[model samples]
Target: MDRTIAVEKELTPVIQYLSEKGYKVESIEFGSDYSKNIDKYDAVVVTGMNKDFLGMQDVVSKIPVIEARGMTAEQVYWQLNTSLKQ
Candidate 1:
């Protein structure tokens, strides 16, 4: 499945690199204008949540969130891999 990831900045080097390799990455600033429905995406990737969107009740459990903070690429990769299986 293709995953839609949200990054704070556009073409962020960190996210860009991941996208170049094969990740479906998108840039979105929560509570601001966005190109698409943040929840419509299969999976959500947050690269350090902003105060406005981080603690918002709407996002807390609406979907599966893959927080970029407090997580390593290895851990994320494994989680994604395992999720795909189930």
Candidate 2:
């Protein structure tokens, strides 16, 4: 399962951990325009601070968006896997 994940630039730990776990991690800005490339990723990880700032909506993507607020990198990884599985 070669999964590609787009993670906010601030989530360095999550990025490194996911990358180490063999997921193709792409670092993205928090408020940058991602709607154009959202379809390319299997999942997206965010800090949860800016919910509507990513310019992405539920209607725009069916991919899972994991919030990394109270969750650790490992938890986020598992969430990604679980979401993808479902």
Number of the predicted model whose lDDT against the real structure is largest: 2
Instruction: Score every model by TM-score.
Output: 0.57, 0.88
Backbone collisions counted per model: 0, 0
lDDT scores for all predictions? Answer: 0.57, 0.86
Candidate 1 least-lDDT 10 residues:
54-63
Consecutive 10-residue window with the lowest summed lDDT within model 2: 52-61
Tens digits of per-residue lDDT for model 1, 1-86:
37665555532664665576576766666664442366665555566545455445444445556566776665665565555456
> Model 1, stretches more than 4 Å misplaced?
10-14, 32-36, 51-55, 60-62
The residue-by-residue lDDT of candidate 2 on 4-56, one tens digit each, is 99999999999999999999999988454677767788998989998784665
Candidate 2 local lDDT, residue 50: 86
Model 1 pairs in collision: none
Best by TM-score: 2
Deviation of model 1 at 14, angstroms: 4.3
